[model samples]
Structures are given as structure tokens and as C-alpha cells.
Target: MPNVKPAMRVIYIPILLLFAAFLVIPLGILFIRSFETSEGFNFSNYIAVLSNQELLTSIGNSIKISSLTAVITTVLAFTLAYAVNCTKIYTPLKMAIKTGILLPMLLPTITYGFAIIYSFGNQGFITKLVGRNLVEIYGFNGLLIGYVIYTLPAAFLLINNSFKYIDKKFIIVSKLMGDGTLRSFKNTIVRPLVGTLGGAFVLSFIISFTDFGIPASVGGTYSVVATQLYQVMLGSIPNFNHGAAIAVVMLIPAVFGVLLLNYLEKRNFHYDKFGETELTPHRGRDVGFGIVSGVVLLAMLSVFAVMFVAPFVSSYPYDMTFTFKHLLDTFQSSDLTAVYKNSLFVALLTAVFGTCIAFSAAVLNVRTAVKGKSSLDTIAMMTNTVPGMVLGLSYLLFFNGSSLKGTFAIIVLYSIVHFFTTPYLMAKNALSKMNPTWETTGELLGDSWLKTVYRVLLPNSRSTVIEMFSYYFINAMVTISGIIFLVTAQTSLVSSKIKELQHFGKFNEIFMLSLLIFVTNLAVKLLCEAFQKKSNKQ
Candidate 1:
């Protein structure tokens, strides 16, 4: 491999060191800890995990629930995506459907679990309206509902993007051959979407499997790997060895997810040519799908509506009157206020620093002649497959008794590494589309690589940078599992506060805090969008 420019090498060293210190070291520590026992280094922890019936049961439950969630979410998401992208629905209706499906991505995952409880629990408002308990808000059923909503946006996004490159001419050709509706659909749509569907299923499965928030809220009497890991790590005894063991076990499915994703990506078919002809919609088919899609969207929206309204009421199912007491009580608490501020501080830092590091890393890997950059890419991508509970516990074990313990800086660092893969991919995608000769152009002008990047590349990728910043900020705000084990009294976050409140059955306050997070994240998102728009116009 050719050597990279001196200036580019300078940029790579710090990022390499950052990942080494924060990501590589902690994970290394975790691997060692998983093998340790009271008798010294051995496989006792693994044996304990395997022999424990409840632990094994949790693993089984997680797989079962995640598999079901993936299938259901994939089917629903594909239908909705197909409707919005392919059908001849009214423009307003299409936009509404898209917005409705994407809305779940904006709020915290914990919110969905609470929303289900408040709307479908025994005393739920919707349940009462139907004069019966429509669905259980605990155990497998509750998790199924919550996970579907939690993972739907991801599946929909991937499946929808696959739709864009598909040529409509294939469908027209199938029709021209006198193929019936089902045959045409199978040939044109399903055939091209096979890889995407597999990718979506794997992605959704990993997300649902590793998620702790939803299970913690509504997984009554049901055991899953995420919640079990939390219990072992943070419960009364606080067993790090067993926790590490559970973390190792939890990683298996995620690894499989990553492998499947890679395989699917390799097999994915790309079409450079798209059809010029528009899709002709059938009246009956369009109207039927339109109504069904509308109902599904409305159902998903109602959960959020319940989340918003439940916080204002004095008491759910008991007090019909709306009051501001929950909001006041939440804000007036000194601890809560500090936690909220700490969240804001951490999110802002993560956004700024994470974006800079991710952008630099993306540039080095994509554009520069940086040798061995693939290692860095591998590490970053691997982080995506690691569960937050696993990563957080690893940090706890790695940094315990160190000076960095209990500091906001550690939380910020963990968050940056935890969410690094997405922004890095975004930046890499944006940069890959630029003219390949930009580096040569800079050389011809006697400009260094760094200078060219500073003046030419960065300015052109402004929208993507803003997007990366927002992604980091919003995710940091809503994430709880990643930072749960690392937070101290001095560095508590709003998401963890919501979890704490949930433990004590403080439903109103939980909803209020969740609403606060939603509003704050929404404000940041809108601000980023406005900035991007202004930059584009300028």
C-alpha cells in the first residue's frame, strides 16, 4: 500500500489512539473478565451461564421475540413503504404515511413501552373504550408490540431505499407478458427485494434483541437477554463476572446479524438504469391498501398521543381532569433538573466531537491513501453489532477504580464510540459521491491534502455534517442502556431518570420526563434542518 500524506497521517493518529484507548481497551478488558472466576481464570462464568436455567430461558425468549418482531415489522414496513413509493395515493396521504412511519424514530424507545402500558394495559384508555383488555401490556405480547414499533423505522428505511433503484420497466415487461397480478408482483417486486428484506430482518432482529428499554418497562415476568444482563450487572449482588458472561452470550446474535448484513450486501443487485414509465395503479388495490395503511399509521400515532396526554393528567384511570402537576413536579425536583442538564451537556459534546472524529475517519478511509484504514473501519463497524448493555458493562469493568470513573467525560466518550458507525457511514457515503480527482486537482494547485479537504471537501459536505451532528445529538439524548451503568450521581441523564421513575411506578413523571426528551430532541432536529436549508440556499 502507498503511504499516506504526512498531514493525513497526522489526522489519523489521534482517531486511532482515541479508539484504542476508549473502544479497544474496554472491549479487551471485557473479554478477559468473562473468563475470570473466584477460582481465578477459568471457564466457570460460561459454565454458570449455560447451567443457569433462567439465564438460558432468557436467551431463548430473546431469540423467539426478536424473530417474531423482525418478521412482523418487515412485513408491515414493506407494505407501507411499497404503498408510499409505488401506489397512486394522494400526495398528502403519501406524505402523511411516510411521516407517521418515521415518527417512531424520533422518540426514545422507552417511550414506546410506556405508551403501550398507558394505552393497552388493564386500565388503559383505549382498552376501556373497547370495554375489555384488548391486549396484554407485559410479557411476550407487550414486547412484540413495542419491538415492532421500535424496529419498524429501521426496516422501513432500508426497504424503502431498495425500492428507489428498482426499474419499473421490469414490472411493465411482466405485465406485457400477460402475467397475472401475483406473478407480476413476485417477479418485479419480491425478486429484486430479497436481499433488502433479509437485511431488514437481520437489522430489525438485532435492534429488538439488544434493546433494554422496552423490555424493562413492560416485560413483566418475562426474561430476555438485555434485561437479564441489566439485572445481573446492576442488581443487588452486582456480579461483574456473570454480567460479562451474559454480555458474551448476548453478542452472538449481534455477530450473526453483522455477518448476515455483510453477506446480503455482497449479494445485493444494483441497477444503474431506471424505468422512465410511471407505475399504473389499480383502483381497488390502491384504495384497499390506502385505508389499511392509514389505520396502521393511526394506531402507531395513538401510542404517542397517549404518551403526551398521560403526562398531563393528574392520575390515569382515576382522575379525568388534566393538570400540570406532573410537569411541575418533574421540573421542580433538583435531581431531575441536574439530570436533564447533564444530558444536554453530554449530547452537545458528543455531537461536536463525534462528528469531527467520524468525518475525519471517513475522509481518511474514503479519499486518502491511508494504509491499514480497513482495520479502523472494521472496529467502527463492529461497534454497531455490540449491544449497549454489553458495551456499558465493559466500560464499567475496564474503568473501575480509575480516575475517569463517574465522570461526564467517560459517558461522552462511550457515547461517541457507541454511535460512531452511523455518522461515519453517512460521511463516507457523502464523500464517495464527490469527484474522484479532487485530490489531484488540489495537488496540481500545490495544495496539501488537509488544506484541500478543509477548503473544498468540508464545505461541499456541510449538509451531511449537520446530519451527522444531529444523529449523534438526538441518539445521545434518547439512549439509556448505553450510559446506564456509567452514570454517577453527578452525571445522571434524563433517560436514566425515566428508567428510575419507571422502577417506582411513577408513571406520570416518567411520561413527563420522556416528553421533555422528545421536545428537546425535536427542537435540535428542527434547528439542524433549518441550518441545512439556509446553507443550501446560500
Candidate 2:
């Protein structure tokens, strides 16, 4: 039995049970739909999906782009993580770089797509100046580039944490024994990171594969499974059956990837002969690395600045006029105000709901020996690695016939499933940091598990809980691909509106919505930091 006071259970249990139901029942519906037709329990949909050339092409393209993105993001993240954590650099510069790298994570995918178009599209000033199609901000190239920007934050955070676990003495010993920088890097850095890098790569690849917003905005003729799912399911006439079929097809790969990641994580553990400790600074590498890191940081900033400025201009490149008319028109001329309101509503709800569920699950898995907690952990892991498109489509299959479809609750459910993994990890990591004896001590004193959680776990893990909430809110505000099918005309989000504006060649309006989403996310992030500081003091 779950030990606790009845009243406390009344408050928390219903919330978690609702989340659990949402997560499981939707995917169950997808599986059932996939196996059924009017003819009953047939594999024809799977066969049709497999035999379709267009579907195959989309699968191939998604794999290619996701692979390339995984490589570029991992390499860049490794370099940046090493530069900051290992080198003796200026504290301000390091903090600035870390913050800047994270800035892209806060903005919507449409924002990145818009920024790329303004800088590289037909009327692009930079493109025209160079007198070349320097880069096509559409099709394969554009989606690939945008995904790299979109998934960098999670990749950086994971790889940096992995680096922090490595012992510094090993590197120092190797360096003192006449090892060159290259050899030392191979022995010390690459060896430790090999498993972690693979995990990051697979995780990012899954994210890019399932993402829809960037591809929808800049994809042009290039189609991915996510965009295809959106078109078939939600366009002109809804083809629920075809969408369900594709959803099933997409889920196969995601489930396989998640399984593979689990297997890899298990095999990744090699008993660390050397214990964890703080790394000693390497002063010589600092100057060279600082400059290189600065250049990378500058490139990232330039993209953001373009995004920031493009909306303010009346028309980008061609007219060079300035106006808040675009912003004003969002409320006056467009249905943007509703979309803005809906996006914020979903974000706030997702943040609160997701954080509660993730924290409870983490507590169950880490702080208590609850039955089936391992399964809960595994389910959370599986969903985290599952592509957003798969989950969204699954929900469509599961809920379209139910009262949940075409509702705000659906969007909240999608956000929770789509972004569950990171927050779970965040919460578990927070719980892990607390001394195990705290709970044991409480048990000896006859305090219930619920009481211990109330007095100790929640208070100590406040910063991490807030971090998870902020992450959920920021990603939900920007996410498009995962919840695309779930969103109705009534629930159109700012991100979807940005995509709509882009399709109609409403560049200025697109920029305006993108800017609004970005600014709102930034404001929320600042608020999270303020709360974190206050919590630390208390």
C-alpha cells in the first residue's frame, strides 16, 4: 500500500493518476487502431505504409538529416562543454557562452526558421550581398540546420554533466607522461565520453526526426514523417485512418530506438577505478579555446540578433523600414491574440502538471521502493526517446473518438508526454543529490514517506523542480510537431500561427509572432532564475 495520510493522498494521487492514464491510454489506443480496420485485425495498414515510396523517402530523409544533426550538435557541444568546464577561462565569458547556447532552446522552432529565412532567403540581404545561394533556408539543408539549433541545449547539458563525472587526475597523469594534447584528448576525454556521446547522439536524433515546426516552415518540397503526419491527419479532410497508420509506422522506429538506448545505457557502465573530483584548470589551452569558443558563441548570437531585428523591420532586406505596426496588428488584424493566449495557457498548465507527475515518479523510483517503479522509470525513458510525431499521432488515434480530442487538455497531455523524459531526469538527479540517510532517518523517527517528502524532498529539490517547470514551459511554448494533430482551430498556438503566416508569405507577421514567443520565454526564464536564487537563500 502507498503509505501516507488520506488528505495528502487526496491532493497528489489524483494528479499523478490522471497523468499516468493520459500517458498509457493514448498510446494503447494507437496500438489498437493500428491493428484494426473495418475488416478487423489486419496488417494491411502496416504493409501499405511499408510499400509506399513516399513514406520510404520521408523515412530515409529523416534518418539522413537526423544523423547529420546528431554529429554536428555532439561535436559542437563537446567542444563548448570542454572549453567551459576544463579550461581556466574568464568566469563572465563562460557564463555568457553557457547562457547564449541555451537561448535557442527558449525560442520557438518557427523563430529559428524565420531567422534563417530572413538571413538566407531570396530577399535576404546577406544572400544578395554574397551573390550566391550561400545556403538555402529551405528543404533538407534548412531543416538540418534548424534541428541542430533546436536540440543543442539538451545535448550540451547531458555531455557537460558527463564530463563533470570524469576524474581530472587521469588527464594530468597522462599529460605529465609526455602525452601530447591530441593523445591526451583521445585517452582522457574521448574514452570517458564515448558512451555518453552515443546516448546524446541517439537522443538528439530522435528529437530531430520527430520535430515538425522547422520542417513545416522551411521544408519547402522536402517532406519528413512529422509534416506528412500533420498533412494527412489534420488537413482539409481528416484521414484519421491514414494518420493512424503513419503514426504506427513512426512508432516502430521510436520504440526500437528507445530499446536500443536502454540496452546501450546498461552496457555503458564500467566501474570507475578513479573516484569523482573537481577538475584542475588547464591554463595554456584557455587562450586558444576561449577564442574558438567566442567565435562559436558569436555565430549563435548573430542568428539570434537577426531573429530579434527581423520582426521590428517593416519588411526585411528590401524596405529596411521599422514599425511596431506588425506587433499591433497581431491583436488587431490577425487572430494572433487568441493563439498567444492559448499557447501561454497550455505552457503554464503543462509546466505545473508535468512537473508534478515527473517529481512524483522520480520520488517513487528513487526515494521509495515502490512496486513497479522500475517499470514506471522504463516507461518514462521510453517516452522520452520516442519521437514527438509518434506520440502526437498516437494520441490522435487514441483520443479522436473520445471527449479529449480538440481540447486544451489534449495539448497539455501532449506536452507532458513529449517533454517528460528531461524533467524526469532532472527530478531524479535532484533526488539523487540528497543524502539517502534523510529518508532513512525519517523512517526511524516514524515519519511517513508522505511526511518526509513534504518536509524534506520538496523543499530541498525546489530549484530542480523549478528548473524542470521552466524547461517544460519553454519547450511547450515553442513545440509544434508533437501536438500539431491534437491542436484544433480553437486551440491554435502561437507556433502554429507562425507557421501559418510563413506559408502565406506573411514574413513580417511571422517574425512578429516568433519574437513574441521568444520574448515571453526569456521573461519566464528570468523569473525562474529569480525563484531559484530566493530558494537558495531560504
Q: Against the unseen true structure, what C-alpha lDDT does each candidate score?
A: 0.87, 0.79
Find the 10 residues in a row with the least total lDDT in model 2.
1-10
Global lDDT for candidate 1?
0.87
How far residue 174's Cα lies from its native spot in candidate 1, in Å, is 1.3
Give the winner by TM-score: 1
- Candidate 2, residues 1-538: lDDT per residue as tens digits? 2343454445445645764676667777777776776788888777877798898898889888988999998888888898888888888989987899888887777677767777777776557666877776789888877888887878898898888777777788897899998999888888878878887787788788878878877788898888777887778996666677787777666677766766777645453576755556657788888988898887666666666666677776756688777777876964888898999999999999989888887887777654455766666766775677777777777676889889998899789877888899889988988888787788789887778888989999999999999999998998877676678789999887776777588877777777778789999999999999999999
Looking at model 2, residue 413 earns an lDDT score of 79
Each candidate structure's TM-score, on Cα atoms with residue i matched to residue i, is: 0.97, 0.91
Candidate 1 lDDT over residue span 88-149, tens digit each: 88889888987668777777788788889888988887887789998777899989999999
RMSD of 1: 1.7
Candidate 2 shows a clash count of: 0
